[model samples]
Target: MTYLYPQIIFSKLFGACLLASLMLLAPLTAQAEYGDVVLNNRAEQSGMRPVIFPHWFHRIRFKCKVCHTEVGFEMRAGANDILMADIIDGKLCGKCHNNKIAWGPQNCHLCHSGLPGLKTGIRGGDSTGGPGKW
Candidate 1:
């Protein structure tokens, strides 16, 4: 019985250590690379608004094909050639922002506010700014 007690305690300690090691490794392994899209100078000078599209944020709402295929958006930024008129004509963002699905383009400021929020340094977690401890 005395010998069995030591074995039991050793097994329990080993299991606890294993569990703790797994917990510590899980976060490091689970970290995902959220790619970024740059709003180019062309987009900035478009006179409409500078739109910085975050792949991470949109990934939560819709699939990649929704914009990439259905909307004919190129993988490269500023390649889509998105224009306000096209949106008004039910193209690009207007495809989803029909008011039935998402917010329509009737409210111009929703997207064209030109105020930097998530993409700019004004809001935190923006990679454009210096990388800090997330």
Candidate 2:
């Protein structure tokens, strides 16, 4: 019974440590700091979460012109009508996500990871798909 005190202290310390860790990491887990652009034009209708586009992530890898100029994505948030078929046909995202440059659309959850509440909220786009109304 003498060792009981030490066990209690250990348990309290462990719990406190875990709580602190969660407090620090909760926001991070909620969403990455990519300044997401939630495109839910047809996602909700199709029974899926909006496409949280990691704008900052790609901006670091490629130049703006690569997508805006070459890919034809407008500067506006909900500008282009990005569809899954267009991607599969090697047009928009399919150009890179074709398994050669990046992983293909086999994994849906990667992009369809529910609307990330960043500074940019769930501002949806057009019916074809962009960033307009949800």
Candidate 3:
């Protein structure tokens, strides 16, 4: 009976450990969506530049419909028909960046600036001079 008691306890402990291991492994299989929206259709047509917009960080603060519906952004990138001139005239980004809601067009480095260290695969963060400081 003494030997049987030890074996039973060992089996219970092993089962518990196995369950915990499986639970920890489950999250590894979960899908993580990292934003990658391309901008600049003219660039694609002219073969000059390809703007990659990261939506994950923006989505954290703002809603999708704010830009999609209110700001007149289309579901897909390059479909919004956004122009730098329009923004300068208080259009899409200008709507919020008009010095009233968000940082105005005077701060051109905010959006016009692309993510640096692309070779290192480093995206948005405070370390990269992004809005992550706030």
Q: What TM-score would every model get versus the actual structure? A: 0.52, 0.60, 0.49
**Model 3 weakest 10-residue run by lDDT:** 117-126
In the range 1-134, model 1's lDDT, one tens digit per residue, is 35568789999999989877865655454322345444434445655555545577778999999988998877765456666788889998889888978889887655654443223212223233222322
lDDT of 2 by residue, 1-134 (tens): 45568789999999989877755654444434535677776666677777888777898899989988888777776666778898889998888888888788877888888753333243322222212222
Candidate 1 Cα RMSD after full superposition onto the native fold (Å): 13.3
Q: Report lDDT (Cα) of residue 83, candidate 2.
A: 82
The global Cα lDDT (0 to 1) of model 2 is: 0.69
lDDT string, candidate 3, 13-85, tens digits = 9998987786565445433234445455443453334445668866887899998889887675445676667
> What lDDT is obtained when candidate 3 is compared to the true structure?
0.59
What do the candidate models score in CA lDDT, each in turn? 0.62, 0.69, 0.59
TM-score, cand. 3: 0.49
- Candidate 1: worst-modelled 10 consecutive residues by lDDT: 117-126
Q: Of the candidates numbered 1 and 3, which has the greater lDDT value?
A: 1
Per-residue lDDT of 66 in model 1: 95
Off by over 4 Å in 1: 1-47, 113-134
RMSD of each: 13.3, 14.3, 12.6
Pairs in clash, predicted candidate 3: none
